[model samples]
Target: MASSLTKDSAAPGTPGSEKTFFGHPRGLATLFMTEMWERFSYYGMKALLPLYLVAPGGLHLNAATATAVYSVYVSLVYLLALPGGWFGDRVWGPRKTVAVAGTVIMLGHLTLALPSSGTFFAGLGLVAIGSGLLKANISTMVGHLYDGPDDPRRDGGFTVFYMGINLGAFAAPLVIGTIGETVDWHLGFALAALGMALGLGQFLIGSRNLAPRSTVVPTPLSAAERATTLRKALIWAGVAAVFYTVVGVSGSYTLNWLLVPLTLAGVVIPVMVLARMKRDKELDGTEQSKLSAYIWFFVAAAVFWMIYDQGGSTLSIFAEASAENSVLGWEFPVSWYQSVNPVLIMALAPVFAWFWLALNKRGNEPSTIVKFSSGLVLVGASFFVFLAPLSIAEGGHKAAAMWLVAIYFVQTVGELTLSPVGLSVTTKMAPAKYASQMMGVWFLAVTAGDATTGLLSIAGVDLNKMGIVALEAALAAVAGVAIYMYRNKVKSLMGDVH
Candidate 1:
């Protein structure tokens, strides 16, 4: 296909001759398609995995057992990103790392097509590792498309990128997850492979555009690229040895213990370095000040993520167990409802982007702090939207479908305001040397949130009725208090984005 994206024929600030869709770059569409397909595979499997493991005709495991397995899978997916991000930075570079990650995911899907617990687990491992490598780096690549830390277009670009993610997620559960749950579990896994195949193909064809990696590569004795290449080989070898011994051999028991120290180190080491960097006279004051704000934003991002990340964990299981999806005498599988959040996201992203920009023009825009606060509040409100249906249900009856849709709608708005904008902020606040690592720090928040969700699930709540209600209520209350207490401080920390 001919490239729809072209350089501005006219000078900077001059209106170009060629038109773009939705008033954004055409390359955004290509990336959108690639991401959409990839997410189709991921969310498709994710939506159905819990049900597949516990359903009557499926793995036939108990709810507790299924949930534990689900938690482990989700936790590993995020946790693995630690090494994935580091390897992308120091060794393979983002582009190659992403490509390799895609290949691994494809293999995972293929392995999932087999009918054995061993194959199922093996597939899950591949998907987890692959997701770890691709997730953070691909977002990093989006930032790389912009020229500088302060580029105004960067936020808009990430919004477009986020939409691509939703487009894939929106379709997956509806089309693929449903098929898998109703038809054949293996068929759904095969469909995931096909989705990855499409993404891998699109990326390979578009490789030239995605070149010029910003992730750090170690310089070596010989000034040439070859010496840098050799050093990277050694780093990856060390990483593989670590994963093999810590996670592979020792099992989940050892994995848990090792992750504690590693995660603590990931967060503490970076902030401590920034503190030292501030005292040095060589750095610009604007730059030094931005660094501090970035740390605060990162802290907030981590907290918000704990609430936001439930979609793939407890929320997925919740949708499977409780949400009613019947209309006109037809029944829909519960997992299919997982599509709602992304669907709402696809519809709302442009509106939120323009809404913020419109407010900015009027000089009444929310600061990044204000936006983050708004996100926190909106997400809390979303959980409460389900309280009514949840309370009304009696016996074995499910909650009304409208409740789930309402929850997703509110959550989508929260995501639109906070998620991509947070990415832009991370890129803007950090200096170049720390750019990729700061992104890792932002994701570490997500990892923390996922881990928290698992802990909450294991809290021995009443799985049938009252337990879910308590969980949602607790989440809402905590989020509201956090936002209220930090509002002024966040606004102050945002400095002058206005």
Candidate 2:
């Protein structure tokens, strides 16, 4: 398959080529499959994590503790991308970093396959590190595949790539979820390891699909810069080791306690990164203004993900404790619900373009920030869809499976509105040297969302689903309205990028 991907004499997207990957590039197929398998690895573990933490034959942690662990684990995965992106550019280059990260993810899944509480946390840590590395670098690599900001195929290409993400996610619960729930959790985790192993092999073979510049150092480190970076890295490593060692020896710190500092880091890091971007001399006034507009988009992305990403946590709990699991005489695992959003993504990816294309023909298409705001509002509305179910459950009736399906449907639409566009917009807005470039800033939005998600999941422990849902929904609505009102200003700030 790798050989076939590169076998075309004219190369993909060339004058004579027909855009071999669904009217795109053949290399897109290789990358598309690579991301697909990687997502299968990711979503496979995700489908199992929440349930395994609390179920029998699992870690058997209490609900609050399990939620804490889930929150921290997911939060740290994106949070670590800040450093992971740095390592990719300044150290190993994006291509090698992705390979290394994929290997770590495989090892992480294998670790989870071991049967012990200790191994569980260890596994999550390793997977988070690898995912952070892979995600930060890989999305930017996708951006590199296109000609530039003005390329018409760029957005569509990313949408295709994004489908690969959901395609893998769609298969996860059906494969890993069914097995994990009906069989051994360890075996399910082992399956995830196998998917990553396959992804690594495919990626290695299809390595040529990557753009030439994508493999080179975009910004090389000078001698003095290298020494300073090394010094900082060593100091941080030593400090982290000693701090964790002291806490470990004392046995006084709980996993929940770690969330405090993590929350702080999530809040601070984005600000610091944005400040670094503003201070960068390479960016012109127009780029800086574009970034200023991006700040609002970032807020929208964070809010949307804070609610949407909870599908694996809060929604999964609903599927377990409240949603009907038996249908037509067949019993299904709660994890089966995990596949809903991804399946919709696969279904909707094609329609998304045509929908916008029709609107563009009418000259009434919404701007990028407007689409982001719409996504935020819609995600919030998805949570609000749970309101009736919560009330119904209070009266002792389980929710119909379709209620969860409805929520997922709405959430998927909202995600499609923003997720793919965000990457392309970030790529267009960012300069080459502003601290991990576009991806770092883009993922910082996710870091902030996931950081707060852990704290928000605490609401689930007390069964305050209605209250939390209402508050979060209302906030998103307000934010969306504000962004819509300010759309013109944001567009102005964006200059010619949009």
Model 1 lDDT at residue 460: 42
Residue lDDT tens for model 2, 284-304? 787788888888889888888
Tens-digit lDDT track of model 1 for 263-349: 444345445555665676765776666766666666566556666665555555666666667766688877767887877776776
Assess the local accuracy of residue 160 in candidate 1 as a C-alpha lDDT between 0 and 100. 72
Candidate 2 wrong stretches, greater than 4 Å:
1-26, 140-159, 208-215, 222-224, 279-285, 431-436, 457-464
Q: What Cα-based lDDT does every candidate model obtain?
A: 0.68, 0.80
Candidate 1 residue runs with Cα over 4 Å from true position: 1-30, 142-160, 208-300, 431-433, 459-468, 471-475, 492-498
Q: How much does each candidate deviate from the true structure in C-alpha RMSD?
A: 5.3, 3.2
